[model samples]
Structure formats: C-alpha cells, structure tokens
Target: MTGADDRGIEHGLPADGPSPSALARERRENAADVLASTLETRDATAFVHAGRGREPSIRYCCESMPHGRTAVAYDGTTDEWLVRSADASDGHPAADLAATLADRGPEGTILTPPHVPHDAALYLENAGFEVASTEAIARARATKTTGECDRIAVAQRAASAGIRRAASVLADAAIVDGRLAVEDGNGDTVPLTPARLRIAIDEAIVGAGAFPAGNTAVNPETVSHPDTDADREALRPDESIVLAATPRGPSGYYGGLVRTLVVDSDGGRERRVHVAVTQSFRSARSLLTAGSASVHTVAADLEAEVRSFGLDDSDEVEATVSGVGLESCEGPIDGSDEIEPGAVVRLDVAARVDETSRLRIADVVVVTDEGERPDRLAAPAHSLSPAALLER
Candidate 1:
C-alpha cells in the first residue's frame, strides 16, 4: 500500500511491500520527481500524458488496463499540478444514440474516442507542453533497488518452475489420436493439444503462486519431416514445442521463462543431444554470477557453451540470449558491456539433431553478483528425460 516516507509524501512501495499497484502512483510520483529535478536544471514546463495500464494497477503496474489517456501538467510558473482526462475517470461517455433511437435502449449521444492517452505527447503539445528535446525514461527504470531485485528474483523462480514443468510434459511425448498424450498426477491420460496444454500450464503456473501472461507455439526444422512445412506445423509425435511465459509475484515485479522440447519415444541420440544442450544451460547458469558481463558477453558465452555440445557446425545451430523484466524479452544485451545490477537476463541456446533436424532444448536464467563475476539471474539447469513431471 502507498505510505508516507521520511519525505512525508505518499509513495509507492517496492516489490516486497504489501501492495504493488497500490504504490504505483507513488512510484510514478518518484519518477516525476526525478523529471522535475532534471527540469529544474533547465527552463521548460514538463507536461506528461500517461496511458492507462493494460492490467489493473491503480496507476500503472502489472495491471495495464488503459482508461484511455490522462494528462498531468506541472506548471513551473504557478507551481501547481493539473490532472485531466476524457474517460469516466474524468466523465462518462454520452449515451448510445442508436439504442435510444431504435427504442432498444435509453442511451444516446455516444462520445467515446477511439484511443485516449494513445497520443499523450501529441495531446500535451497541443496544450502547450513543449521541450527542447526528448529523452528516454528507460534510465529511471534500468537499475533496481535491493527490494525490487528481490521481487524480480521471486518472479523468475515462478517462471522457471513453469518452463521446467512444460519441458517434463514434453519428455517421452508423442502424438496419439490427434493429441499429444501424457500421464498425469492421477495416472490418467492428459492431452497436449495446443489450447488445452496452454490452459493446463497456466493453471500450473498459478498453482505455484504466480500468473502466466502469454503463450505461443512454433516449429522450425523437423526430424520426421525436416524440410517440409510440417516442421512449422502444429505438434505431432517427436516434434518440438516452444513455450514462453511471464510470471508475476504478489508484488508487481516480473521475470520470463521459455522452454523448447522434442517429443520422443525411445529417447536415443535425440536425448543425448538434448542432454548436451542442458549441460550448456547449466554452464551458463554457473556463469550468471558473473558481475557486469555485457549483453555481448552473455550471448558469446552462451553460443560457446552450446557449441560445446558438438552436434553440428555453427551453421546448424541458431539461438539468442536476451534481457527480461517488467516486460518479457526486454532487449538483447548484444555487445554493450555492463548489464548493470538490478537487471535480470535470460540466456538462450538451441540446436538441431542431425538429419532428423528436430529443434529441441532451451532454458531460462537470471543474472546476479558472484564475487568478481558479474551479477546475473538464472535458474539451475536440469536434464530432460522422456516423462512429464508436475511442478508446484
């Protein structure tokens, strides 16, 4: 919940605090304070138009539901703040005229604009909020406090658990009766159909005390049908399914996890190849404590480790290592040195299994400080067998 700090102004609490969204306004106010301080060094009135959240946070957090757009103007001259909006938060839309005309309803004179707050900067400009230049607000969000970092860690744990469980369900998996079948907790059969599987995994994530934000499936390269469009098609026996999910803790901080799997019957060479990939994942996890390793270092190290698997030439493998946070796939550290503290990153690596060409195996990681090693966030890497295990 929002509380007055020593400054005696109500402010948002960090992730470990009792309320996430309740404190969002406080956090935004702190950000505005930073803006104001910076503005004080210059000579311009700062007017900010913030969009509604997609979720349901009071101001903006995990709850991003946008209530159109809201405007906040800081008048340097008057030393006053003004808030305005077109939505109900400000005023309700006129009633529906068509419904009233048809006698089907009593509403009339609808006045809803397509997208509010959608053009905040433009709106501010129209209302006279001008500046010499625009700068990115990302810096304010980059580094994290100890509490924010802790909350991120918890979110990462939740995401990791979800991916690991999905991987288990893929092990020893096969297409049966137009559905990927697996044994469940009750020894009853479970179907791995796309939509059904998504629902089940989402339930698993929530059961672990987190929430799943999104799900998607893709196929590239194939064993049974490597060169054909079949590889890009839906799951069948011995195919790979990639699942990515973001989990949020009770606090609003978030982390990302991704899983790549190959359905197999006997788990022969395919299993060995997957096991090798898993080992590389473990190696990356071991290195995550590396302090200030640039995005480049993370990517290079992951590529090197994946090559350690020794399946094919570099041309045969494709993968990416990136940053994760409030938004999944934050960005690729690429080659910029220094990911800095408070940043959580996921290093990904993948490969195909010879002529079979099954694209299989992937993992999630976090970066953290480890003595001289740059701080990185990553989960413990584990091998994949041909069996699905339920994760708490």
Candidate 2:
C-alpha cells in the first residue's frame, strides 16, 4: 500500500506555486472549515474557537477527515460556516455565505468559545444575534468516537514500543567513561547520547506504523531532569534515565507515555520515587469512572497520594490529568466536566527525588461504561529496575 507521504508526491504537482508543507496546511484548513460548516448546517449554531488572533478554529474542524467527512471554508468575521453551495458564484466565500443565510433566514444564535475574537463577537452582536459561551464544542471533542479511540490506541501502542526499545538499549549498554555505549550494527561500540536515543525512539514509533508527533526525551541525568535536547551528555552507571514518548498515528490522533529506569542501582531515593509515582498513577487511573468523576477530582486525589508518600506540596512533583486525542493535551476535564465513557485521558506524574535524581511515568487510558473498567492502551511494565524491563 502507498504511504501518506508517497501519495502526496504521486500527483506530480508543481513545486513552485506552493511548497508541499504549505499545500498540506491549506488542505487541513479547508477540511476544518467544511467540518464546521456541516455542523452549523445540521444545528444552525455557529461556533468560534479559532487559533491565534484572526486564525481559524483548530478543534471544531480538523484538517484530516479521519472521521470520513468533507472539508469547507470557515469565516470568523460573519461568524459563518461557509461551504461551496450549489448556487455559490465564483466570488468571495463570505459574500456567498451571507447570501445563502439571507435566503434561508437566520435560525439560531451564534455560539462562541472562551477565546473568540473580539471583532467577530462584535459583528454578531451588532447583527442583532445573541452570542453566548458554550463549551459544547469542547465537550463533544473530549468524547472520542470509536474510530478516534482506535487511532489513539494505535499511537499509544507505538509510543510504548518506542520506550521499550530505549529500555532494551539501556539494559545492554556498557558504561564507558561514565556514558552509556552500545554496539552498532557493524559491531562497533559507540557512545549512546540523548540524540542517538531520540533517533531510536522515532524509529521504533515508525516501525509500529506511526510518527513521532511530540517531544522525545532521553535524559541520562534523571536527577536534574533537564529538558531532552541534542546534548551529548554522558550516562552514569546506577543512575536513573527518563524516557518520554508521544507518537501520532496515521489518522492524526496522538498518544503519550513516559517511564523512568535505573541502570544497576542500589535502590535508593530514585527507586522510592519510582514506587511513589507508580502508586500515584494507579490511584489516578482508579478515578476515571464514567459519569462519576472528573479530572479535577483526579488531580486532587493524585496530589494527595504524592503527599502521602512523605513529599510536601513544595516538592518538585507535578501531576496533571489531561484529555488526549488529536492533540496531546486536549480539553482538560475540570470540575465542571464529567468523565464521559468515550473520553481518552492521560495521567502524567513527575517528581524530583533529590537535587540530582528524578522519576516520571505517564499512561493513556480510555474511560468505559458502567461495569466495565477503563482500558489502558500502553501496557509496558512500569519497573524501576533495568533488568526487569530487559527481561520483557
């Protein structure tokens, strides 16, 4: 089967008029508009949740029609969802939509998200239309469709594979000059830097039929827990290394996973932190019951679990309960939003054991109906010992 990239170039389109990247972006925008327009037509309610400034909405309409839908053009100025109507002339889209609306007569009020543009809101108000803040769009997005959930699961599986590959490399790596070194394909030992591990992670995700969509961090010095970059830092023996991967599936859905491993450790503060994080992750997962709990409740419960581990609020511990879908961080389910059955959420926790040691773990879970437990997509064993991961 031809891959997405291969199909992009199969058309043999001219490269001068618009770069491939630009054309892809335009296609996405057009698709998003179409989605918004379709929804508006069905409900007669226009939603505004554009990107920055005068930019378009990134959620209500998506670039890819993985949900099997057509694309259209969205106009924020008139708070209109415009599509290529059968009677549309070869003129401005905004004008065409206005004419169409006039012919059909106004039906419902225009709804705007929290971050709608001021001018657009003003236009709707002056046109004698009531504009209200409705989280319906965001709430609808949080409840993933069956196809969306499947795509997320695929990405999560890919992310887990990538992290597992990194662990394999770490388990067999030789501590050379306080840095991890592994034998290359030609049987020559080479120092394994953050960059090299990152490449390995990306390759693993691709091998699993997905793309590395988010940040891939391989931190040798787990204590400092510095942001993963291209730095060629040495890997010390008996130290913890944090590996976090977020991969995107072919359907434009994302999944995330994070794990910490120690090489030949004597089971000290790092190990303690790992145990605490694992317990906290389990605790958070238990709270993802449909129609009963919200992410706000989960976040509070997770923090309490962390404190019960003898870590203070001031400790360098971070725990977040966020919804994950097309975007790595989607609509966070606060106190107002319930944990719906189809919601896909990520519980991420990171803590600094001491000045130079840290541990982190994350997992993606799908909320299910009553009598059914939440489904965990990434199933790698969360172990602190490198040998345990290697054995798998």
Candidate 3:
C-alpha cells in the first residue's frame, strides 16, 4: 500500500505522471522483482539493508523515515517492506537492523548491497542470518522509470533557468579596457568574473527551487569540473566561458545542461573548439538510441567526430555519455555493454585547447525505445556568443 513521505517535497509532477505515493509504490514493486530474482538465485530468505539509502527516499519502504538512517528488507512475498524502527541511541545501524530482524521472524540467508558495513554483516551473522551482497539494486536504478523521467524533467526546467541566467549576464556585460565588466543595480561598474558569474547562476538555480551543487563550473578551464580559486580572476574579451547548469530537483533527481559562450571573439581557436564540441553533442546524442548502441560505442564515436574537427579531448575526461539518476554519473559506462531503454544520460563533450583552455557542451538526454531517436532535456541550442544563444 502507498504511504505518505512527510520528508518528501511535493514537486508537483505533471498531471499525467505518477504522484509521489504512486511512484514510490512503483519503485518498491520494481525493486521487489529484482530482489525476488536474486533471492531465487542465492536461495536467500530475505534481503535486509542498514545505514543510508541509495536515494534520500524511495527506499524499500514507503513510510516517512523518522530515523537519521533507515533499514528495510524485501521478502518478495508481500507488498510491504520489512522495516523496523529504531533510534540512534539504541545502537549503531547494523546492530539495530540485526536486532530488529532477529526478533521479527525466522533467520536465513539475507542479501544486501556490496558496501553494507562489516559490523552490519557481522551482526546479522551473529543474529543467525547469513548476509551476502548483490548488484541487483544498482542494476535496477540504472534504467529510468516513467516516474523518474518525469521527475528529472522537472529538474531540467531549473537547470535551463540557471543556464539562461548565466547567459544573460554574459550577454549584457561590457568590454572595458579589454576586461569584461557589468553594472550593478545602482549602476556601479563591477568586473564580470567566474566568481561573480557563479553567484548569479547559483542564485537563479536556487530561486527556481533546485540545488546547485553540481553546476559549479564557470570558466572555460573548469568546464567539466568544479570552480577553482583562479575563477576569481577578471574575464577578458574573446575568452570562452563555460556556463553549466547541473541542479538537483526537489525529487532528488539531477539535471545537466552546459553551453560554452564567448563575450567577444576574434574568430580564433575558441570558435573551432566550440563548433567541434557542439557537433559532438549532436552526434553523441544521436548514437545513444536505446538498445541500438552502447555508451562505450557512443563515446568512441564522439571522439572520432571531435577529431574530425581537428579538436581532441583528453584521456582525463570522463565518458562522453553516462547514465544520470539519483547520482550525477550512474552505471559508469566503461565497457562494451548495450544501453537499456529509459536510460537518462548526460552527454559531456569537451576539447582541450591547451593547459589553461578548453571548450565543452553538455546536456541530459534520454534514450527512447528501439528505432526512435533520443530526446534532449532542454531546448536551447549552442552558440558562439552568449547574447545570441540567450536570445533564443
């Protein structure tokens, strides 16, 4: 039965999408199927977990977690999850869960995630339940559910707002003495730097009701990563700025959007790199058709496409295409494995121009069923100038 999550925010999903309680029901049932398969394979009695959930909510149980940490199990027999409420003062998480399960019912082989604490496993063993680890839960989360997609789409709106805010700031700045500067509300002149730009972007994201933790990059050099102390430096004309928006929505789902822009350009190498990365985004987005290709193949194809434009990404860069969900990078596409449908992935393509210069464009995209093209999370397209891009 579906229950309320007092801790969960009412993200107000679209009318056609599942409600929070409905989505929670779908998640646990879907997770139960995977757990049942694992139980059959391992001949286990039930699956128990302790400590934190992979996601803030939507754990095996649907009730509001009253504890700092929660523990729940799946028996695959009932629609309900095996949950035992315990306080932190009682003991550690593993001890609490072990004690809770010990008194509840018969003890047998129990499965868990690989990272389950040693003490937790030991406590379970001491309590007469054999504990083993399985990758089933992780596997289940990789494929985006219908409700998860809708939640991510809500997050995407916030990301788009942040990107637009950042672009608007860059587009309105004036080139004074070769330095980019902007006027305050009082009409006082101030230098437009990454530090200033990040504040505007983050505020915009927060105003849109999303967490801006993942969208830290503002300078060209920090495109794919976090901000640096050097980001405090003043921006100069004709330099590329990578404005990224990777915010987490109220639903705990993440959204990603990145665009490289220049205040003014002499039509130099920055333009070439921008063009290359943009094409990489388009081509990589195409190759991520669900069931038609693997992310590994798409990354390789992206490399070749960027190479065709005389620009190349560094080995240090992450996989050009990777699944996104509760975490920013999910499933870590590293090998030749076919991507499943309903997988939401981030396409991050960057070209290295030197030690201090790089250009990148990234977007969150979802793979559709076979023979259909993938879809982008946001609508804005790439442009060399922030002004023209924001105008769209």
TM-score, candidate number 3: 0.86
Q: Give a tens-digit lDDT track for model 3, residues 183-296.
A: 987999998878788878887877776677645568645533334556766787777777777777666677888877777777766776667667776776666643557767
Best by lDDT: 3
What lDDT would each prediction earn against the true structure? 0.48, 0.65, 0.70
lDDT of 1 by residue, 1-392 (tens): 11211111112323444344444544455445555655566544442334443322223221222344443333334444444444634331111111122242212121111233334434333333342443313433444444556666766666666666566656545567755776667987766555444555566666655556443233322323223444333455554565555666555556665555545535776666666666666566666655566666666676666677666564365556665545555533456745655555665666666564554444444444564433445443443432443332
Among all windows of ten consecutive residues in candidate 3, which has the lowest summed lDDT?
1-10
The CA lDDT at 332 in model 3 is: 38
User: Least accurate stretch of 10 residues (summed lDDT) in model 1?
Assistant: 1-10
Error of 1 at 375 (Å): 7.3
Off by over 4 Å in 3: 1-18, 53-66, 77-79, 88-107, 220-229, 290-292, 312-319, 332-338
Q: List the candidates ranked by TM-score, beginning with the highest.
A: 3, 2, 1
Q: Considering only N, C-alpha and C atoms within 3 Å, which residue pairs clash in candidate 2?
A: 34-71, 34-72, 223-356, 223-357
lDDT for model 2 comes to 0.65
- TM-scores for every candidate against the unseen true structure: 0.62, 0.76, 0.86
Relative to the true structure, candidate 2 reaches a TM of: 0.76
